[model samples]
Target: MDFTFSTEELLIQQMAREFAEQYLRPATRRIEKENRVPDEILAGLAGLAGLDLFGMNIPEQYGGAGAGYLSYVLAMEQIARVHCGPGLILSAHNLGLGAIANFGTDEQKARFLPKAASGEHIASFAFTEPGTGSDPKQLTTTAVRRGDEFILNGAKRFISNAGYQGPLTVFAIEAESGVPTAFIIDKFCPGYSISQPWEKLGWHGGDVVDFNLKDVVVPLDNVLGKIGDGYPILQFGIAYGKIGMNSLALGSTLAALELAVRYANERTHREQPIAKFQAIQLKVAEIAGLYESSRWLCYRLGFLANDPKSYRDFAREAALAKAVVARNAQEAARISLDVHGSYGLMQDAEIARVYRDAAMGPQIEGVLHMQQIILAGDILRKR
Candidate 1:
């Protein structure tokens, strides 16, 4: 396997890196501290870079650039390297689009993909209910069929883009067939409302809120894929999404390490840069090693996602990548913070913001414990 970037991939990666440094880096700290991301900022990102809804893996026919998974992962890594909140929003858009690109019928694609790809309508996913996290089969949100439309009556918590006043891609169980299904619920839908803003420890740039669907009626044409196939559809999209999240964690690790190294070189102790000290050198080396390892694993998973035949086999690999990288990033952030000394903990410090964001890594995609157990179970069962 030739794990090398082609000229095109390199160019794309460079473009993403430039955008990250120029557009995202400067305001990332402010976004985190203020805990409010202006809608105009998000719109500007989408408009300027066309990243608002760039689903790199989706075909151009559906408004995507017809890029591959590797390109998508590389772009995500660059974006996350600058700021995780926007990175996550981008990741959610890709995941939501992937589901429709892979499974949605022509009508479904016609209705959403063009707008989703162009960032005309910011996208979101609603799977985790009030209590259902890992066990989605226990979902209580139900959709009862009433002639031409289905009445959706349930609430989803911790939904990204919850109050953004845009279309939302929702999942619920159909009452008649007891089958899980996906639907596009526009913000104008009467029963849809964002209840409250969720104050989070990290990822403040990404709007997180609780949504209530009180007898919201969605047309039958809005259903994604088959009536009862939402489970596998969501699972597949989430597996890919986890890869993107892992890339986010890896990118954050790289950023933290670079920041620490820079700080160490500039700060001197006893007429010598702290970077020259054995203790600082050791921490820097550790950070480099962890970042390199996690990054390669993330790339491998992205490449493996190209073919659907091996997707199931990649589930454990994806989960493991997310778990390992997230933990490594959390540690890297803390160590970087320590390297900065008292300044690191300052409310205005970027490292402090990164430290807070890093704390969220292990909990974002999937719980580390569950992922580790799943990896072990997959190994034992294969044996």
Candidate 2:
């Protein structure tokens, strides 16, 4: 696979890096303490929407940049290195938005794509129920066809972007057909309400909403793809989520790793830099190694995403990328803190926030163990 980036990807990377340093980093303290991303920053992020920073991989006809797969992931990695709120928000939005781009009808695309691409109307994915997250078959949410509308009843927990004013694409079993279907339920729909946002462990400053859909009425025009075809659509969204999450992991870890290296060199012992110490050297090496490995893995998956027939094959690749990067990102953050010694653990330190942000990567998009199981199965099948 070619490692070179096109002119567009380079521009996105540079622009995102500048945006992160100039705007996002300056507000890190406020974000970490307040756990809120201001609307202005979000709107600033929207300015890049035309560059596919938010709408990457979405076709140009729909008002996005129609970026190549690598461009999308590269933009994510750049922004994620500075802050988790925007990083995860963009990824989470794209998680369901990409599905709509791929599966929605012409009218549906025309109705939502341009606005969504411009970041005017954000989208959320509602799939994780109260007791079911990874296992969709156990979803208790059911949608019943009634006249011209589908009546939905169930609660969705840990839904990203639910607090935002936009449409949510919900996943539920169609009672009569016993087929899982994706329905776009507008925030204004009847009986559709969001519970209080959850206080998250790491990715804060953004909404993580719980959906309570009691007889939520959605028009027939809202269905994404055909009935019983939700699986592939869901999987596609998930694959992109993993892909972006992989970038999130890489971005945060690389940031921590580079900072640790600089700290080691600048910090001194016996009037000499700590870079002379082999222990510090080893930690830097480990972080570097993981970053390189994960970067290549994510890049490879970007290429895999281009082949429509490689969807399932890309599933395992996405999982592997997420699993490895998540684990390694955590390790990198820990070692980065170690390099700073007690200073890193101090509440006011920047690395402390970075550590917390890095902590979220492994847990989301399915746990690391699940990804490992998928990877193992892929290995066995190949052999």
Candidate 3:
């Protein structure tokens, strides 16, 4: 892997960092407190720096930067270090667009990719149902084939972009054939509704929509891939998405560590800087180790993403990266809070927000035990 970034990469990194410091960090607390990312704010941010365009891996022809995984990862890191909600929204939109750009038919690409890549139409991926957590094959949502339309009836709980507000790519099992399929369901679809609002432990500003589709009619042209082929497409898309999430978590943890180090160095302990204390030195050292390890793992995953054919073999690695970084982030946040003491717990402090937000990592996206199980299975298979 090349450690050097081209001039373009450096410029993108600097640009993203400035956006985070200027717009995202200033409003991070307000968003977390209100638990709402106003549509106007989202739109303004999308317009200002074209946050949606830079982090996307889609091609320039599709109105994106045509950047690489590392570029996206770096941008995600910088944005998430201050505010993961905006970062997640951008990531999900890009992931949805990436899925279609890579797998969709020419017409599908021409229809959906441009709007999504340009950030004119936000994209959301709906795969997880209440009945099916990690297993797509067991999805209870059913799509029945009609003449020129498929009638979709099901409920999707804990969806990222649930409201019909955003353009959606929904996955449901075709009833007759028992095959998973992806559909481009428009907001005007007859029987689609966001039934409930979900509040999460972290990432408060992002929407966690619950979709209820009752006799929803979707045209045959909306099918994302060949019949019975949506499972692989979704799996591949989510693998890359998880890598981006790991990058965000690692970046947040590093930011927390930096905050802690600064606090320790300037903080006075018996008329001398607390940096002189061996305990503070040890804490900083441990944080440095955690950040370095997580960052390297994220880079390795970026390299792996460059060649997707190798991803199947990397499921365990991806799961491991998610688990390790999630755990590392929470630990780092706690250390930062402890080092800062009272100041860290204040709502105005960045560490407090980072502490609250670090937990969004491990909840559903490859929990530690799940990753351990996968890693153990890989070990046994290799042995």
Candidate 4:
């Protein structure tokens, strides 16, 4: 098996690293303090001459770079290492974009993708509600047909990019069929309103909020795929979403490792560096191992995502990778914090921010235990 990245992949990875160091690294403090990414940074990420980081996975015809999933993952790792806010934004945006790309008709792609790819709009996927965390059966959202338009009513919770103007892919139960369906609707339409952003535990700049859809109108043509197809579309969107999530976690893992090693070498004990301590050495080794293992799992998942033989199998693998990588990132952050000792506890410490960011990976997308259940079910079904 060829384990090396191609030249193009390396170039994209380098470009992302440079962008993160040049732009995101300097702005990290502001982003964390303000809990918002500047519009200029977002524009640069999208409109930069050679670095269309925001549209890495979109097709070239859609005003995107079409760099494929592996390139996207590589770029995300670098972007997230400096700061996870941009990575989180891209991850959620791709979740909505992936659903449309995989399930939407040609007309739908033509209409929605160009502007989204250009970063003129940020896309969002709305499926989770206050009552239904990951369970689709408990969805309270309703969509009713009215002539050529559908009226939607529901409240979506913890939806990322909902506050932004873009196409939102929403899942709801149809009044006539009683079957769950997916619809593509514009955000901030006549009947849509969003709550103030929820102050989350980490990833501060990635805005997530609850939104109310009261008699939201969408044309029948906006129905994604077909009626009763929301389940598969949700599955596909989430499976791909895991790719971005894994990349973010892996980046956090790498950051934790680097911080631990740096702290070990720089911190002195009795005029000697802490790197001389066996305990510090062991902690650094553990963090390195976690970073390496998580890196390979994320890269493999990205490769498999490029052209999966079966999305069912792909989803299972994504679940497995996310479970391991997310846990590794959290563990790595913990170990790094231990290395930092009292300093890491300070709110402004960089390692402290990494700790909070890593803590979020296991909870978002799907909880760690939920991923375990998915893996267990897949294994038992194969048996």
Q: Top model by TM-score, which number?
A: 4
Top lDDT model: 4
lDDT of 4 by residue, 1-383 (tens): 99999999999999899888987898999999998888877875442224776577889888888889999999999988989988898899989988988798999999998888878889999999999878889999999999998999999999999989999999999889998899999999999999998888888888999999999989999999998998889888888999989999998999999999899999998999999999999999999999999999999999999899998899999999999999999999999999998999999999999999998988878778889999999999989
The positional error of residue 382 in candidate 1, measured at the CA in angstroms, is 0.6
Per-residue lDDT of candidate 2, residues 1-383 (tens digit): 46788887788788888877887788877877787776666764444453456667778898877776787778778777887787777878787678888889999888877877777777788889889788878888999999888899998999888888666788999998997899986775678888887877776776788879888888889999988877777777887788878888888887888789889988999999999999999988988997898888877777677664677878887888888889888888998999999989887876787788889888787778888998899899989
Local distance difference test, per candidate?
0.78, 0.81, 0.77, 0.90
Least accurate stretch of 10 residues (summed lDDT) in model 4? 44-53
TM agreement with the true structure for every prediction:
0.94, 0.95, 0.92, 0.98
Pairs in clash, predicted candidate 1: none
Between candidates 1 and 4, which one is better according to lDDT? 4
**Cα lDDT of model 3 overall?**
0.77
- Could you give the candidate ranking by TM-score, starting with the highest? 4, 2, 1, 3
Screening candidate 3 with a backbone cut-off below 3 angstroms (N, C-alpha, C), the clashing residue pairs are: none
